[model samples]
Target chain A: MLNYIAVSTIPIMIFIIIIVGVKEKKDVYNLFIEGAIDGLKIVYKIFPYVLGITVAIGLLRNTNALNIILTPVIPLLNKLGVPMDIIPLMALRPLSGAASTSLVMDIFKNSGPDSISGKMASVIMGGTETTLYTITILFAAAKTKSLRGTLIAGLLADSVAIITAIILINIGII
Target chain B: MSKIWSCIILISIIIAFLTGNPNAVTSSVMSESKIAVENIITLTGMMCFWSGLFKIFENTSLLEKLSNKINKLVLRFFDKNELTKEAEKNMSLNITSNILGIGNAATVNGIKAIEAMAKVNKSDKPSNNMTKFVLINTASLQLIPTSMIALRTLYGSSNPTNILIPVWIVTIVALVVGLVSISILNKIIK
Candidate 1:
């Protein structure tokens, strides 16, 4: 079923593109080439930025940096009765969406999807944005040289989501 | 990004060496190298495909038609018709992409949208509108979290859609809080 949907989407997209191209009398092939070139350029531009972040994430994970760092903060959150399992996910969510997602998938693998922690992971993942990624990529692209109040505001919102998710679960809403 | 990334990797590597586990860094790079290349390839292709489509969308003026409705809401929210044309268009497109859960595509426009906003403001420092743009952009209200739903289904959830309500509620609250606070901060700071 998933395959069917995936396959259908591409053809449907192609069909629409072709129709639109014809309607607009656009040079579809050339426009496509131009877009591909632009895309490659953007990917090239961001590749180093992405590599840097990915390596940092990988090394941090393997070296247990997050674990070590979170140890001190864990007690505080623990005192609030936030589930221990999803703590790493919360810590990583603002860093990279993909990284935290891989962590959430790991949670699902270790525990069933219906588990309390699993639901919480899903909620937090969906509710919050990748704050660091958002700030880094957008601000960098815009050449906003300074870290401004935006970061604080976004992180504050994420914390609200985190607290809300925990509250909802503890109250048995999920 | 450069500063943040360098600080993180540098600190991580230094700590690894100091802890006598430098090999961990090597292994991480080796493993991540393959995955990162594959991801970058996929991301590049995905971006190309969408950009091509959006190019066509533009040529056909379909984008204009589609964004027309969304721009109404944006105009009302921003409470002005004084937005530069490019800014208004980018804002509508960004919102449309986010609602459709095309996040990577949304980022391209999000950057463009904010830049456009800043351009209109004609100020070096972020104006209230620009700051508000980043706040809501990061809050990222989504109608369909495609990745979340897929992950849930893969995990054998009987009803994967169950996460939708919680996600919506949380996101809405975040959006509200972010908007209100950013506006308040804007007044206080500037």
Candidate 2:
């Protein structure tokens, strides 16, 4: 039953959305096409950002620098029972969504999606936002020069989310 | 962004040369663009599909209805005089789309909300309500986390949705922490 709901969720959502569109007398097909085009435009806009982060990450990973950098922090993480594999994800997540997505894919590839590291990475990804990205864009829109405590609060929340993910996975609660 | 990008590349190149593997850096620089494009291609399909569906939702009264319901809850977060009705409406729409996990739509509404709030404020600095709203958005509590689930399925997870409950728990924890801290900071910072 749970699996059924899990798989059917999107389809059910689509159904309700369609019903709502129809009742509202919307040009649903045309609107969807327009929105899809907007989606394409969004992807296009983010492509350069994605490419930049991807190459940066690739260089970091391919050069073994990622390991070198993490060496110092690994012992502390190990003491907390945190898996070493997810360290990159934790570090990159708040900075860039594209970078972290790539890292999550890497985690899925290396550890398998059902593994503890993969589950924790998934939970962390799902739970948190790209804090820096969102803040930059929102503040730019608002034209606010002084962010005050927004950045700190957002990062703190991200930390809490990551810790919660680790604890939940470690306790076998998920 | 520029500083962080340069720092990462600079450090990576330095480490690569020191470790005597300049070839690895060169090859990664050459090949990663192709990998990035491939990842974008994979993401594009999902983005278009969900954005298309969300657009349909936007055309209907459903989004407005949902936003109206959320507005009641969101209003309590702000002082009654701090937000105009227009800002409150946009805030509700932003929060509604965010909770629904339609991120692109959420971003559009979020920008609108912030812009609305900006017009009402007298200073260049962010107002308390603006700070609170941005923090809530940055914490980004989603009920479904649709994109993550899709990525998990694409990776052939044996049980992709198993992480759903855990994500919800974590999201709530993050949001509560965000709200509490922002409130505390609002008092101390000013």
Candidate 3:
């Protein structure tokens, strides 16, 4: 069951890791500290990206700016049987995982978890990438020269996810 | 990057001013930054725990073992001899973690893989293989949708895993479409 796997995955991993560490005669605790510190540094590095996106999205949402920005596409999307409410989630999903994540929470809170729209939104979030964030941080870490193509392609894939999620919902598959 | 960042702030300010709710921007910025900080703070513990466990996995060469096991399969996605050995290693590990549904490790491997590729490629722009790598990560194929199911359960879905079949279907379709699109674009552009 999903619940069991989700609940126990970490503990199982930890158990296996401890055994492997002992078998290798390794100081697992210290190794973990080192990795933890690295994680700390990573969080520090990526925080700005996360914060900028959140602030931008929060402002748009609080000021009702997103509605105005998205209003033009609403009619067409509606005609396509796309759920009116999830369009923003689709647009933002590839942009910022944290922001779209909070949006998913909002949908679940308001729509109830069992609603088709809620389930569909959850599926989209799960299936797609936080494309911009991943590309930016990874390319920066890699020191790659090409940034534009990655972002564009990532966004294109995200659009595929968006359309696929909508169609599945329309077809009553989810 | 600077252009997009500045444009976002500028647009937010203009929207606030035109909407006659300038205070909303300030309040929202403050609250959202707080949320972001909180998000990081809470995730830090879990991140640390997993990172530590992964290190043990890495130190004992378990990662390398798994990486080697999948190396042949991973190579099929990439060109033979196009990537350096280091790049291939990272890519194999990345693909393995992705298939296992462990997103965190997948990302770490992805970045490392790109780093390896960058070292080998002398060009300034993204190399062909790097573009494929990005698309693959974007449409990652994993066995479990753990996070989504967890969220669904947290929100009271009786059958949180109901999307299991649909998620796989959509992800695979997205992956195939993305690969085809990128390959076409690559040919047209190059």
Candidate 4:
């Protein structure tokens, strides 16, 4: 898998290097280095937000808050044909991918990878997004404030992801 | 708000534990460390690859050309008379990051886009534009969901790529909904 991605990306990388170096009259190596640095800078800036959110989520799960949230929703989701076990994942879907991933890992560990619950949760996590967090941090970085219709729109989009994930899993698309 | 939810969840867990079914709460906490480490590795790798790709694209001037081409459509979304250097940079960054499926990376760029838009939208509460941009950033379409695929691999899934179709579908739908809402809301506000 690593080899496939690496090999495929090579042509792309070389193409970029040639175009930037010759056509654009830019230093491809320096741009590569700078980009990497910028990437690290981004990670550094967001690290605090990531840490706080992760720890808060951790504490919440530790105290059974997620279960409480999931308990009522599970029946409704299941009635809609969404897997009962995937409810927690669905709830976490709009938070952070890494955070939901940690949650999904736990689900996979307990339920095992082959279980329907695990499969469905994986699909949902992979399919949906953390709309609020994305909006918050992005806006904060640029120093903008009002949400307008964004919250509604983002949540609605997440619902689409959740519903699509359930439908796909049920139909055995994978 | 989180604290209130925490208290409620804690009470419920206690109730469930007393009732003799504790697996739900127990399992959720048990899987943290492994998940955390795995995600870090996957995200780091994915971000590295994407950023690398972005730099290469930028170096080639492809991103700039693309930015200019999309400027009209982009301007329509947020009517700013004069596009600044920072705004152009932010837009290119947003586009590149979104394409690579790293919305996290795009947030900063999105903010810059909003900042540039703010200069032009002087009368409006900056928060309004900020929020709208957040929606767009959150709904940003991802062509290659590297972090998600990595998570699947970490969890030992047989077919990580199976998620591609659904992700593509949801991403596009979300983008459409987000854009429509912003446009409608802008009209209402105006």
Candidate 5:
């Protein structure tokens, strides 16, 4: 039942939006084309960032450097009941969406999408924003010199989301 | 970002050589770009479709109506008269689009909101309201999480939306913590 609702959510949303657009007598086709072009531009802008982060992460993973780096912390993570596989996702969630998404895909491939670690990764991905990127881009628009409390608060929120996700998964609350 | 990126790549390459796996580095460096391009291609379709749909929302009164509903809830975060009418509208639209999981649209509105707030700001520094707004954005109270769902489906999740409720719970927790912390920090920092 829950799965049914989840799958239908997007389709339902699109239907409603289309219905509303038609009711408003708007030229939905032209607007969609314009917005798609804007979307293409956005993707173009972020491609370099995505490429850079993806390759860096790929190197870290393929060279076994990530495991090596996490070796010392593995026991601590285990003690906390956090799976070692999700360490990269947790670390990268705040830094880069593209990196974290790639990490989640890796988790899905390695553990299968229904595994505990994969579920946790999915929740974390959905729960948190790319804090550093959003902060930089948003502040640049306003020309804010000092981040002051924003950065700290943003990270604190991310930490809370990560912790909450792990706990919820462990407790089988989800 | 540059610093972190360079450090990760450099450290990975160094470790590869030290670990006697320079070949692994070579293979990954060649393959990762292809993987990155593939990921972008996969993402482009979803992004374009959602952006187009959201554009329809924006062109009609749909987004405005939804944002108006969100504005009432958003008002509590700001001081009385702290926001200009334009700032309030853009912020509401930003938050609304964000909740709807149209991230590209949300970003456009978010930047507009910041610009509106900047006009009303007294000092060169960001105001408490501005920080609070950005904090809300960073909290990212998304309702749908479209990209994650799409990726899960692509990866062959038997139940792609299985994590949806948990994601919602976590997002709410994050937003509450973010707002509370920002409120406390605003008093302390200034």
Candidate 6:
């Protein structure tokens, strides 16, 4: 997908060159280079943070810290009527999907794909995203550190999703 | 950072467990690298695919057309309609992405819109208008829920679209509650 985006931008660059020729009456080549350079500049600024987060995710997974966090949250989630198997997704939602997918696979294998627990977890997986990924990319793009209620709002949204899923499933609403 | 807090909690629990407090690691938490990987691929693919689709829509002018239509509603919420033509187009793309249940994509578009908005703003910090934009993005409107539907299909559900109604209800409720709180918060902070 990343490769596709990089490839797709080429035509857009060509269109700019055409516009420069037809309307701007300026140097088309220079405009193309400037455009590419601007993109490269943005990429350079963003790469380091992306690398750091990726590594942090890797370390957390390797150390089994994700499970460690999910442990306590599970019982409370279950008591709240959340499907126990879906707890890992909540923990994974702050990191990367690479980590979340692995948890999903585990839930599927253990609980069987048809089980309510497995199904609910899968549904939650589809409906939500990792909070960190959304925050990091959006905030970094805007060059802002202050979250300004985004985190709380995102968690609340996911909580609603989970609760709704459980309630509906238990009632056989879905 | 939440990460640091999580690490501390993990270490404390592990130490407690090693000291014969095995209850520290509840039976509920279990790590499976394989399951996590599958979820990552599927969800990320869905997000990227939707984001890419939105970009395509922008290139096709569908986004701009929609933006013009939504301009009235946006004007009411934002209290401004002074955006340049291009800015309106960008804002439309961002808003549409949120309405489509693609938060990741919406954020990408939101960043672009913010930059455009900031360029036009006279304020040092984010403007009231900018705050309203962020509030709307954070409280995003979702309809299809492509990711959730994809997950349902993946798990072998007989009717994946069955989730649509429930998703719509909760999303509407969320958007309403989120908007109200942000409006209240906006007044308090001001």
Query: After superposing the true interface residues, what Cα RMSD does each candidate give?
Result: 5.7, 2.0, 4.4, 5.1, 2.0, 9.4
Candidate 6 or 2, higher lDDT: 2
Rank candidates, TM-score, best first.
5, 2, 3, 4, 1, 6
Count of backbone clashes, every candidate in sequence? 0, 0, 0, 5, 0, 21
DockQ for every prediction shown:
0.38, 0.70, 0.48, 0.36, 0.70, 0.12
Q: Report the C-alpha lDDT of model 1 over B1-190, residue by residue, as the tens digit.
A: 4565576678778878878998998998887665556555546665666566555554566655667878888767684644788887888888777765556557878888877776665556676667777777788577655557656766787666677778888898888888877777777665
Lowest-lDDT window of 10 residues in candidate 4 chain B?
B32-41
Better of 2 and 5 by TM-score: 5
> What's the TM-score of every candidate structure?
0.68, 0.91, 0.74, 0.70, 0.92, 0.62
| Model 6: per-residue Cα lDDT at residue B101 | 47
Candidate 2 residues A44-105, lDDT tens each? 88788778877887888889988898899888987897987787688889998877887786
The runs of at least 3 residues in candidate 3 whose Cα sits more than 4 Å from the true structure, single-residue gaps closed, are A1-52, A81-85, A95-118, A132-152, A169-174, B1-45, B81-84, B101-127, B145-163
Give a tens-digit lDDT track for model 1, residues A1-174.
644553354456568767988877889878777776776787777666456555666677777665666777888877776766687677778887655655575567567677888889988888888887777776666665565578777888888988888788777875
Q: What share of the true interface contacts does each candidate keep?
A: 0.51, 0.83, 0.59, 0.41, 0.81, 0.10
CAPRI accuracy category, model 5: medium
lDDT by residue for model 3 (A15-60), tens? 8778989998999889889888876776677677667766776677
- Tens-place lDDT digits, model 6, residues B68-113: 7876676676646546555565677778766644454466667887
Question: What residue runs in model 5 are displaced by over 4 Å at the alpha carbon?
Answer: none
For each of the candidates, the C-alpha root-mean-square deviation to the true structure, in angstroms, is 5.8, 2.2, 4.4, 5.3, 2.1, 9.3
Clashing pairs in 5: none
Poorest lDDT segment (10 consecutive residues) of candidate 6 chain A = A46-55
Better of 2 and 4 by TM-score: 2
